[model samples]
Target: MTAAPAGRPRTARWLLRLHRPALIVWACLVVALAALLLALRGPLTDAAAEGWRQYNACQGRGRCTYDQDAILRYKDFAGYANLALNALPVLVAAWAGAALIGRELESGTARLAWTQSTSPARWLTLRLALPAAAVTVGTGLLCRLHRLAWAAGDGRIDTAKRWYDLLTFNAGGPTVAALALAGLAAGTLAALLLRRTLPALIAGAVATLGIAGAAALLMPRLWPAVTLTSALDEDYPNVDGLVVDQGLVSATGARLPIPDCDTGAGCSAAYDRAVGYFTTYHPVSHYWPLQLTTTALLLAVTGLLAAGSFLALRRLTGPLRTAGAAAGTPSTDTLAGAAA
Candidate 1:
């Protein structure tokens, strides 16, 4: 068999190294999560049903049963259960980000990989794309599955599904994807700036989260997308002070009862004083636009992060001695492992 060209093979080798250490480990963990999530489906279904029953029982006595918003809050449990019970794909992704180019530079391996047939661009692309693609697919697939369950539970396709229904829900939202891309970008940026694995890892985590907050805080300001309002229209008169129009929630919740809600008084002899409250109000949202903008922004973040990583990789340099360089540490190990 003919030997492969120096370029493709060398670049492939670097990527394979990266994947073996990070992306492959991420894939394996995702498989494990998918299995676990599947395994518990029966219990979760039962729980949801039981929870519903518990709620209604409370209502019979005119008591608030489950917190109306618990449905939304509990969704995070899916992601929590996923991580608390098993390995987390995000942590693994973070670890991988911490390591990526940093470990290689730390161990002086990038020099070896780059010295061979791999040109800077090919080397960087291979190094970055394969592992990241794996991360995206692994996380994205799991998120897609999680959303499947959630969408089935809720009638409409939820655009900003909470982080916990499954970490995967976060995958669908623009902010989370942007944050994720920021994570990878932060890693590559750290790789370029720090060279040492440990510092890069720490810096990457802090920077990514910081960027996420700032982006969430500031980006929408510039983008200024039309926000959605979440009020239910009932038969209540539109008298201003008679009802308080609530601002939209950042997440979704099960329908709440207004004293005279749903334009009917089945709940109370007073024609559902609860019914009247909501009767005059309805939860309004533009599902179509919310979903479209969210999807667009998320895709944009993915592109930007990829572009950032590509640019960072193009500028990568070999490791240099830091001030008072120490040989090894636990943090360093965390940043250098295959799981990283």
Candidate 2:
């Protein structure tokens, strides 16, 4: 048999060829999402902001009215786009498990290729590498576009999403890219472990969802939070910051929930003076720190999963090597074992 190409580019090409339909779908999805974001940044946001301006200016008149339709349209489109961006990683995970790995293994295509000219290790590497590169590039581009669109509406559109909003936080930073890569790794591992398309697809999507949920829960704790203390009568400062916790602190040093006080009427004056409001939050400045920390964590998980995939492939191919040797057909694994 003719010798297989030595570099990764050839293997990458083969992997891409096998998954060309997925590649096309992913490309189209990215383009459509990006277009929507761009439209939101320019036309949709401008229309909403103009409506807000008209409404604010009409105050004190007999009746106040503005372009309610424009505002509603902007809100609906923005929400849909945000949902798409947040769900992109899960889609990647599902496709990776069902098409990229699970289908190949279930149909014996992977084993056939392994026995032909490719080592199991090489095949696994190419599988992971190609998808990883595509996911990174696609997700990274979307993240950058999302950040730009989000920033453009800051202080301009009243209905714009907040920095600390769940979907906004994940899409407007590196977290989306990290999550996408994590999904790819997770899906590959699930496919390898289950060796069935439907089961692996379900398991991979569920795993990705769990990881994303856990990350969202842990995000605020990744960095130290700043505490702001204020008199009970006064409102908490930094309303724009991401608030992790807010409660009342008693003079006796016990933390308590804020009392149901009606404009300083419900609670006793003594209690009001004794208890102050304490807020723990991460300011906007902490965005990079939080994003980088989470990205590091997700990349570490991806590395572990990749290592496990290669190890599992090695073990699975060992018996195949023995069978091939007894049949007098030198398997790719046997050739590599002998060379080593």
Candidate 3:
């Protein structure tokens, strides 16, 4: 068929032409979120930090005053933005399943395309590659912006997000990008398996949620936790650290619930000296290790899903090719008939 025009430009153009609406929506969302993050990093964070400084300096001065409105506004925007970023994977999965692949399969457009100069494998590749690139770039940019916005308020604003918080952990690192890719792959897989729009969309979103939920539950255990044991009278070390578990430990090495003891003389005297507090936590240094490990696991899942999609495509096309050969013409109409 004249060598199919030599490059993937035509295929990419076709894919973009088919999915222009989704692409535009994604672009607008990215731009909006990025603008919000930029504002957070600059004006919002500054206002909140200034308010905190004022409040801290004026504490117990009887006439303390600060811009409470600015703090509230900053916190509101930060929280909403974080929520949107964390939900990006579900959005990607929905679009990938409902529009990208399922619609094509349901409407017979994919089969028609295969009847043209394209093979089922190439069609599936274009379906996945274009969306993967777009999702990766968009999500990766958002991750960087989120990290910048989050770090801008760190140590300055008292209510800034902690590293271990769910939204913060996913949004501020490579984990979001990895999740996006995984969602795309999952959606594509669901679309191929279902071959129907609505069912595929629901299945894809559910699959994405399952993957993200599991990752959230297992992330803390991926690395060895650091344990810090200290005398109950002494303050716990690294109070700002991401504490996974903390409890009181007896001299016999048995863990126990922390006693309701305060710093008062009576409480301290009643507390047993042999009962110390032990905190198992992830220090700030473990951030990259956790992020990278989770990202790797997600990317591995994406690869497996992509491979499965290709294999599914081959299985789908094998009988059509056989039928076309049997007809001796092996033309578009013959293959299209076989697909039908």
Give the winner by TM-score. 2
Model 2 residue 190 lDDT score:
87
The per-residue C-alpha lDDT of model 2 at residue 111 equals 75
Candidate 2 lDDT tens digits, 239-297:
66789997777887666666667856756653664557788899889988988998888
Model 2 ranges off by over 4 Å: 1-12, 233-238, 252-274, 319-340
Per-residue lDDT tens digits for candidate 1, residues 1-340, read 3455775687577557657856566667778767645533444544554565567678658746654344443455554644432223235335645567778777876655544444445556666677666655665666555545544444221222332232333443333534455567666766666677788777777766665455434332332233223233444334321122322221233224433435555434333222223322211232223334544654565567567665665445323222224343224333244122
What lDDT tens digits, residue by residue, belong to model 3 across residues 67-169?
9998999999999989999999999998888999999899988887766556677677777776788899999999999999999999999988897888899
lDDT for 292 (candidate 3) = 95
Give the TM-score comparing model 3 with the true structure, all chains together. 0.85
Q: Which candidate number maximizes lDDT?
A: 3
**CA lDDT scores, all candidates in order:** 0.49, 0.81, 0.84
Ordered by lDDT, highest first, the candidates read 3, 2, 1
Per-residue lDDT of 28 in model 1: 73
Candidate 2 lDDT for residue 68: 84
1 against 2, candidate with superior TM-score:
2
